[model samples]
Target: MAKYLRNLTCTALFSMTLPMTAAAEESEVQDMSDPLAVYTQAGLGYTDKGINVKVGQTYDTGSDTSMGMNVLEIKGFAGEALGWNGRGADDSIDSIRFRNFTVDLTNGLGGQVDISWDFDSNQGSASYSFIQALPKMGMFNFYHSLDLG
Candidate 1:
């Protein structure tokens, strides 16, 4: 009985000393350095840091021109505007927006027109829309991107 007990103790100690691996709260395909919220450690919609901001500007005052936006995707947007005399009724918009657009296909083929309305102007506060009849093309090609590592 004594010899059997000794062997059992030794076996238990050896098993405890053997190396073991534990799976973290991560996966093999997930990236640890990626900043996107999809695979982030803090979970979706959680901002680890205070804030991140980016700005861009384009100005061209040549002639009255219009551009057609075929496909536009706005992944993110953050803006700041000024108010009129700090009154809620007189608040105004002086802000910037971030949007990505693919308009090469409809650039010269489609004529562009922009129309706006405002309470500050002769026209009262309202909205406008421009409709277009596009010609169909038989051949269509889709653009895509792939990341393989």
Candidate 2:
């Protein structure tokens, strides 16, 4: 009876390990020379629970030489689980979405500007808009504008 029990235990253990060994051999393992290749391979099995964002700003007390035009700027950004395929390989992510985003700018001369955008994948919708309120003289007065395209 002792010998029979030992044989049964060995058989059970070998049977369980056979499938695992086969699976490991079937999957190809490639040698990655670049760090980016390793990063994308490892990211395939990753997921996020959620996202958190914190926004802050700093004010400089030091004064700088300027042409006598005052400008105030406000900016913000927020989003969740936006994934990248890394090289257009189509790993798992299908689309991107943004909940809320905004930006505002104001000048000392009572000129103001606002920009906002919202995007979603489920509804297949996206919206982008901006508003400009400038004084009669205009927001900017420049001799030449730079265009890089």
* True-structure RMSD, every candidate: 24.2, 23.8
Local distance difference test values of all predictions, in order: 0.26, 0.26
**Residue 6 miss distance in model 1 (angstroms):** 76
Q: After superposition, how far is residue 32 of candidate 1 from its true place, in Å?
A: 31
Highest TM-score against the true fold, candidate: 1
List TM-scores for all candidates, in order: 0.18, 0.15
Lowest lDDT block of 10, candidate 1: 42-51
Global fold similarity of model 1 (TM-score): 0.18
Assess candidate 2 and give its lDDT. 0.26
Give lDDT: candidate 1, residue 13: 44
